[model samples]
Target chain A: MTCTGLSAFPLTPIREDSVDERAFAAQVTRVAAAGVDSIAALGSTGVYPYLSRAERARVARVAVEHAGDVPVIVGVGALRTSHVLGHVDDATDAGASAVLLPAMSYHPLTDDDVVGLVETVAAHSPLPVIVYDNPGTTHVTFTPELYARVARVPGVASIKIPGVPTEPAAAREHVARIRGAVGESVTIGVSGDPFATAGLAAGCDAWYSVIAGTLPEVALRLARPALAGNAAEAEAENVRLAPLWRLFTEMGGSIRVIATIAELLGIAEQPCLPLPIRGLDGEQRRRVAAVLEALQIS
Target chain B: MTCTGLSAFPLTPIREDSVDERAFAAQVTRVAAAGVDSIAALGSTGVYPYLSRAERARVARVAVEHAGDVPVIVGVGALRTSHVLGHVDDATDAGASAVLLPAMSYHPLTDDDVVGLVETVAAHSPLPVIVYDNPGTTHVTFTPELYARVARVPGVASIKIPGVPTEPAAAREHVARIRGAVGESVTIGVSGDPFATAGLAAGCDAWYSVIAGTLPEVALRLARPALAGNAAEAEAENVRLAPLWRLFTEMGGSIRVIATIAELLGIAEQPCLPLPIRGLDGEQRRRVAAVLEALQIS
Candidate 1:
C-alpha cells in the first residue's frame, strides 16, 4: 500500500473543544465512499499537531475504523523525536497503515539534522513512512538532494512533493528532477491541489491533496484525466478547480476554506483548530457559498 | 519584582535526552550571583518548546529554587492556548514570578488572531504575563498597534520589544513610540543582544537578554552604563561586545551560540537539542572559543 492516486486528508471536525468523533467518522466515511484510493487523516488539513496525543490517537482510530478498505495514513510529525516516536506508537496502536513525517522545526535544520531525523523515525516506525515535504508550514525545505537522501531511508515507502514550480514549463522539469533523482523505487505524490494537473502531467504517482479531502469528486474529476495522460481534459478540470483553489488561496489556507465548504455542504461542523485560530468570517463564508454554487459541488 | 534591568534567559543544559538538572541549577545560580536583575529559564535560549511539559516544569522548579533573591520568568508559550495554560500552571507551581508569551504560530496570525490570543492567555494566566515579540522565530510580528492592544490585555504586565531599528537615531524613537503607545503602566524591555546599546538608549525599561544568561558580567558591563545614562560608556561596552554579537548573528541565532559558550565554560553539557539538530561545527566552535578568549569572559 503505497501512497498513490487520491489520498483524502479528511479534516478533523470540532464541536466544542473536543474532537467531534461521530462527525469525524462520518466525514471519513463520506470521503472513503467518494472512491478515493486512500484516506490520509491528520495531514495539514487534519490539524495533526494541534490535537493532543490522546485526541490524535482517537481521531486516527475513528478514521481507520470508518475508512473500511481505504488505507489510513496518520501524520506523526512533531518537534521532538521522542514525542514523534510517541506519536508513532499511537499511530501503530490505532492500526494506521502509514505515517507522514514532516520535519517540523523552529530553527532551520542542517542537512545532518534532517537526514538523521528521518532515518531515526523510519528505522523505528511501525508502518512505512511517507516523507511529507510541506515547507510552507514547517519552514524546513527538503531540497532535491535532501529528498534523495530521505528516499534511501529503509522505512520510507514514498515521497510526497507538495511544492510546484511557478513557471508552467518548470512543472514537468521539477517533477522529472525529483523522479529522476529518487528513481522508480519511491512513489512521488504532488500536493498543493493547484499543481495536480501539471504535477500528474509531469509523472508524479499521486495527488496527496486537500481539496480531495473535502470535495472528493471534484478532486477526482481533475485527477482522472491528469492520471490518464489527458492533458487538455485535465487542464479543463484544473480550470474548474480554480474557483475552489482561489478560495483556498484567498482565505488564509486549505484548513479554513475546507471548513467553510464542509459547513456549507453540511458535511461537518466548524473545524476544531487550535485556539487563537478560527474558521472563515461571514463574508468569507458567503464567498465560499457562491463558489460552491458556481462549481455545482453538490 | 518587575522585569527591569537585565533579565537573563539561561540556556537549558541537555545531556543525552534528559535535562541536566544540577548543571541547569548551577547556571541559574551563576547568573543570579552576577547581580543581574532576574533569571528567565526556559526561554528561546532555554529551548522552552523543545522540552516536554514535565521537563519544562522540572527546569522551572530547579531554576526558581536556585535563583535566590532574583525573579524567575518562565516561558509559557505554546501552539495551543490549553498548552500555554498548562505551562502557566507549571510556572506557577514552580514559583515563577512571571511568564513570557511569544505568539508561536505555524499559520501567520491576523490582527484579530493576535489580539484574541493574548487577551485569552492573559485573562487565565496564574502569573503576570510578559508579551514577547520575537517575529524572527514565531513569524508573528506584533505591530506597535498589536503590541499596544496586547499590552492592554488584563494581566499583561510588560512588553519585550526584541526588535531594534537599524539606524542608531531611530532606536530611541522606536522605543519611545512603543513606550508612548503602551503608556507608563507597562515596562518595555529590548532584546536581540546587538541592539542592547541602542535599545537601552531608547529608554526601554529592561534588557531581556540571551548573552546575559551565559556570560552575565559581559551583559551587565554593557547594561550598567546604559542604565545609568552613560551613552559613551554604553557605546564603548557595545564595542567590546561586538565580537560576541558577530557570533550570534553569523551562527544562525542565540540557541547554538549560547550552547557553545555554556559548554566551553563548563557551565552545562553539550545541549541535546531535539534530533536532526546538533551543536556548532568544529570551525564554528573554534571561532566561538577564540571570541570567548578575546573577550576575557573568564
Candidate 2:
C-alpha cells in the first residue's frame, strides 16, 4: 500500500451521553471535501474508550460512508483482547481500510506485552493493523525494540507516535530509529501539533491531525509545504499555527481540543466528554476562542 | 464508627482464568477461624482489576458469605466510571461493608478530578467508601491535602495509604499528617510492610496487611503483638514475615505476591491472572516456593 501523506483524525463528539453520529458524519464530509488524504475514526481525539461496542461500529460505518473514496482507519482499543478483535471485525465490516490498536488500556504494559498485543490483533484483523503508541495518554511507550517486534507481525503496517512540542527532538529520533529498525515494512506517522514538520523531515511518513477534524484546510496547507520539501514555508506555517497548538495542548490534550474546535466550527451540537474529563474553565475557553478567532476558524 | 484494630488482608487465588471461589471461600473461612480481625476482598493482592464484573461480584459475594462476621471491603476499579459504579453496586448488594476505590484507571487524574470522583461515588454508594491510594500501581498519588478534601465527602470514611519499608519513618510522618488533617472524620489505614506498626504508633487507626492473606496464623501473630501494644514482640514477628514479604515484593507488587502465596498454600488451584499480568516465571516460582516452604506455609 502506498503511504498517505496526511490523515484527518475525526473526533467523535458526544451529544447528551451517546455518540453524535450526525456530527461525526458531517465532520467526515468536511474532511473529505477539504482534500484530506484519509481519515481515522474513534481515536483518542475521538474518545475511543468511552464509546460502547455498538457506538464504535456505527461510527466506523458512518465515517466510511462520509469518506466515500478516502480510506478510513477505525481505532480498535479495548481492555479485552476479545473486545479489540470484535472491534476489528466491526471496522472491517464497516469497510475500514485498517485498524489502530493501542496496547492494554489502563495498565502499564511491558515490551513483550505490546508485541503479544500486536501479534494477537494482527492475527484477527483482515486488513492491515496500525500500532498506536500514545505514551502521554496510554502511559505505555513502545520502545524502538518493541516497535521493531510489532512491525514484524504479519498485517501490521503502521505506527503512530504522539508529536508534542516538548519532545520534538525525541519524536524525530524515535521516527528515525523506527524507520531504520523496520525499514519499509511499516509506515511511521506522528499525531500531535501541526508542527510535525520536523518529524516528517526525520522520517515520519504521515501526519495525523486532530485539528483536521474541524480545520482541514489549515492541516492541508501546513502539510503541503512540508510534503513539497519546502522546510522554510512549513516552518512559517508552523509559527502561524503555534498559538492554536498551545491552546489545544493547554486545554488538556486532543480530546478537549477536538471537542472545543468542533463546537466552534458549528458542526457539533454539544461538546460532551465522558466522565473524568471536564470542559475547559472560563479562562481557558476564552483563550481557546481567541486563538480560533485569530485563525479565522470560527 | 469505632476504629477496628490492625486488619489482616488475605490474597484471593485465581485458577483457570477465574477466581478460585471454592479455594477463596476456604481461605476466608480459615482466616476468620484463625481469629483474624477482618478480610479485605479485591485489594491489589486480589488481582482486582483483572476480574470481570460478574467474577468480581461473585468474589465479593463468596467472600462476604464465608467471612462470617468479618467486614469485607471490595475493590471497585475500572477504566470507566460506569463500570466502577457498577462494581460498587454489586459489592454493596453482596453485603460488602465498604468499597476501596483507586483514583487512577483510564486517565491520569488531577487532585480536583479525584475529589470530584470521590464525591460523585460517595453520593451513589450504599456503603461507606475507602479512598485507596496505591501510587505504585496507579502512578498517581493522593496527597494528604487531596485526602483532606475527599474526607469531607459524606460517605468517604477511610483512607488506605500503602507503606514503604525503606522509609518507615516517612510513612509514620505521613500517617501523622493525614490523621491531623482529616481528624476523626476519616479512619487512616496503612498498607505496607514496615510501616504498619509505625503507622499505628504514629496515629493511623488501622493497618492493612498482605501477609495476612497467605499466612493468617503468622499475620495474626504479628498483628496480635502490635494490637496488644507489645512493640518488641510485633517487631520480631515482622522479622519472621520479612523473607516472605521480600519474596512477594520481588515477584511484583501486591497482586503477584498474593497470587503466588495462594498457590503455595494450596488455596488457589492455579495462578491465573487476567491478560497482561503474566504470573511468576519458573525461576521466580521456584524461589517463591522455596520462600513459602522456609516460612512453613507449604
Candidate 3:
C-alpha cells in the first residue's frame, strides 16, 4: 500500500553489543503512539554493516513484533547478492512489511545492473521492495533513469532517497522525475535531516526521520506543519532540530547520533559501536548533552 | 624472513566461469621455471572477491602446490577482518610461505585503528605478514607515518604499495620515505604497471605483476634487467605490457582484468565474476585478444 505521509525512521539502537530488543520495542511504541505513518529498521542509522545475518533477522523481528499495525521496512543491502537474497528471506520470515535495498556495493552500477538487482530482490521478497538511494555511503547514485528502470520491476513499492545538501540538485530533480516516470505505483520517501521539508515539498510521498528515535514528538510536530504545506512553521522546527542533527552528522555521523540518543534516553546503558567508530568523548559528549537539554529531550 | 631482490606476481587467468587450475598451475610452473625469485596468488589480478571463501583457499592451494620450493605469498584481503584471518589460516595450511594482507575493507582508518588491525592479524597469522596498500580500491592512503606505525607492530614483515600513476609523484615519495622509516625490518614491494620501474630503481624490494599470470616467461625476462638496475630495459618491457594493464583495469578494474585474461588464455572457459561485474563483451574482448597476441602469449 502507498505510504500517505511522513514515516519516522528510528535509529535501531544497539545495547550490550547486540540488538537492544527492549529499547527497540520501546522506541516502536513511542513512534506508534506519536502516530508516525511507518517505522524503518536497519537503515544506516541502525549500523547495517556491523550487523551479522542473525542480528539483522533479530532486529527485523523485534521491529515487526512491536510495530503492531504500523508497517516496518527492513534494510537488506549486503556486499554480496546472495547475502541480500538471504536477508530478504529473513525479513519475510520476521514479518517485515517491506525491504529497503541500497546499490552500495561492488562500485558504481549501470542502469541495467540496478534493474537486475531490483528484479532479483522483488522476485524473492514476500513483501514489497523499496529502492534506497544513499550515495553518501554507497558512492553510487541512483539516477532518475535508473529508478525508472527499477520501478518497472514487480514488487518494488517505494524509493527512499537521502536529502543531504551535499548531494547534487539532480537528486531532488530525480524524485519528481521518478514519480512521474513510475506514476503512483511506487511511493517516494525522503531521508537525511536538512532537506526533509524541502524533499516533502518537492513531491516526495513521505519523510524519514533519524531524530525520530529520540525525539518522536519533535518529529511529529515538524511533520504537522511540513505536510500541511506551512513552510514557515516547518522551517522553525527544523532550525530547533538542527543542533541534534549537527551532533549526529559529526565525526561518527549516524552511528554516534543514534548511540548518544540511546544512552541519554536511558534506553541503552552504553554505546555498542563496532570497530571503526570511536565513541564520542569529552567536549562532544558535553555538547550532545547540552543540545538534548536545550531541546527539552533529556 | 626478509624478502630481498625481484619477484614475479603472475596473474591467475580465469576461463569458462571457473579458475583454470591447470592453466594456473602451468603459469606457476613457468614462473618457477623462468628462475623468478618468488610468486604470489590472488592479487587483484586473481579476482579475489569474485571467488568464494572455498575458491580463494583453493587458489592459494594451487599456487603453493605448483610453486614447490619457490616462496609463495597469497593475497588475503576481504571485507571482514575475520575473513582475512581465515584466508591467512587457509593459505598457511595450503603451504604458502607468507600472507599479503590488503587494507582493502576499512579505509581512512585512524592511526590507532590501523595499528590494532595489524596487531590482531599478525597475532593470528601463522606466516609472515605483508601489509598490501592498494589505496585506489580501498580509498585509504597509507602514508609513511602510518606505515611506520604498522611496521612497529609485531610480525609486519613487509608492505606492498601500488605503483600506479594515479598519484605518481606521491607514490615515489612514499616508497622513499617508507624505506627510510622502516629500514631493514620491513621489505617494500611495488604494484601497478606505470611506476614499477621507478619503484624498483628507488629501492623497492620487488615488483608485483598482474600480467605475469598470463605471460610468466615475459615477466621473468623483464624483471631480470630491472633487478639488475637497468631501468631503461625495464621501461621498454613495461611499455610492452601496457596493453595488458589497460585491459585488466577496464570495467571492474583489477577484478575484471583477471577474469578477462583468464578467458583469453584458455585457462578458464568463461568469466566467473560475482555480482556487479558484467563480463567483458565485444570491444573489450577484441582488446583482450589484441593485447594477448601483441604480448605473444596467445
Q: Which stretches of candidate 3 lie over 4 Å from their true place?
A: A8-34, A164-174, A177-183, B1-63, B74-94, B104-109, B164-171, B180-183, B248-252
By TM-score, how accurate is candidate 1?
0.97
Listed in order, each prediction's TM-score against the native is 0.97, 0.91, 0.86
Model 1 regions lying over 4 Å from their true place: none
Candidates 2 and 3, the one with greater TM-score = 2
When candidate 2 is compared with the true two-chain complex, its DockQ is 0.37
Q: Listing candidates in order, what is each one's chain A TM-score?
A: 0.96, 0.94, 0.90
The candidates' DockQ values read: 0.68, 0.37, 0.31
Number of the top DockQ candidate: 1
Residue A106 lDDT, candidate 2, scale 0-100: 50
With candidate 3 superimposed using the best TM-score fit, by how many Å does residue B1's alpha carbon deviate from the native? Answer: 4.5
For model 2, what is the C-alpha lDDT against the true structure?
A: 0.75
Question: How would you order the candidates by DockQ, starting with the best?
Answer: 1, 2, 3
Higher-scoring candidate on DockQ, 1 or 2: 1
- Lowest summed lDDT across 10 adjacent residues in model 3 chain A is found at A164-173
Tens digits of per-residue lDDT for model 3, B1-298: 4565556565555454456678778878877776767787887666575466787888888888888788998888765455677788899899988888776542234566567667878999878888878866655578788888888878888888877343446656767788877778788887775567678767788777665555567766677788898878877887787776676556556555656666667655575555544567779778777877887885
